[model samples]
Target: MFRFIWLSDQRWGQLEPHLPKNQLGARRVNDRRMISGIIYMLRTRCRWCDCPAG
Candidate 1:
């Protein structure tokens, strides 16, 4: 969701400057994929261990 991304960006701002020399933030991802996965979980109300592997 847009709110999640906005919050993530704010987190990145606080993290970017203090990260260790060899570290990067989280891997970049397609927001749509994340949204879809979340929707699937919400609709099904499945346990985390049951999530389908990509």
Candidate 2:
């Protein structure tokens, strides 16, 4: 089974569809990713270059 918790950024979905997309060509891929990353970093105490940032 899978468990899920709403991300902080997802709470801003109401404004997503209204924003422009980045160079990645995503009009709204959900800011949840950025928020989630930041949150995970806080919990892991890992440097950005240690993983994704690397």
Candidate 3:
């Protein structure tokens, strides 16, 4: 089974400033959640659609 680990507040604080803002379209999902999902998929070698929802 895959274990999901979320980003800590401190890490999110450090990373938040570097993420780009979406100015033209609808607001994007939470960066931390998106990044966590990506990392989980990469680590588990799973398809994007197979990744677990938050």
Show where candidate 1 strays beyond 4 Å. 1-24
Name model 2 segments beyond 4 Å from true: 1-29
**Tens-digit lDDT string for candidate 1 (1-54):** 322222256655665676445447886565545655676677667688876676
- Residues 1-54 of candidate 3 have per-residue lDDT tens digits of 557978889988998999998677877887898897777778878888764565
Best by lDDT: 3
lDDT of 2 by residue, 1-54 (tens): 223334645556665676566667535554666656667677767687775431
- TM-score of candidate 3 versus the correct structure, residues matched by position: 0.69
Query: Where does candidate 2 clash, by residue pair?
Result: none
Candidate 3: give its CA RMSD in angstroms: 2.5
Per-model C-alpha lDDT, please?
Answer: 0.58, 0.58, 0.80
TM-scores, in order shown? 0.44, 0.42, 0.69
All candidates in order of TM-score, best leading? 3, 1, 2
Q: Global CA lDDT of candidate 2, please?
A: 0.58
User: Which pairs in model 3 have colliding backbones?
Assistant: none
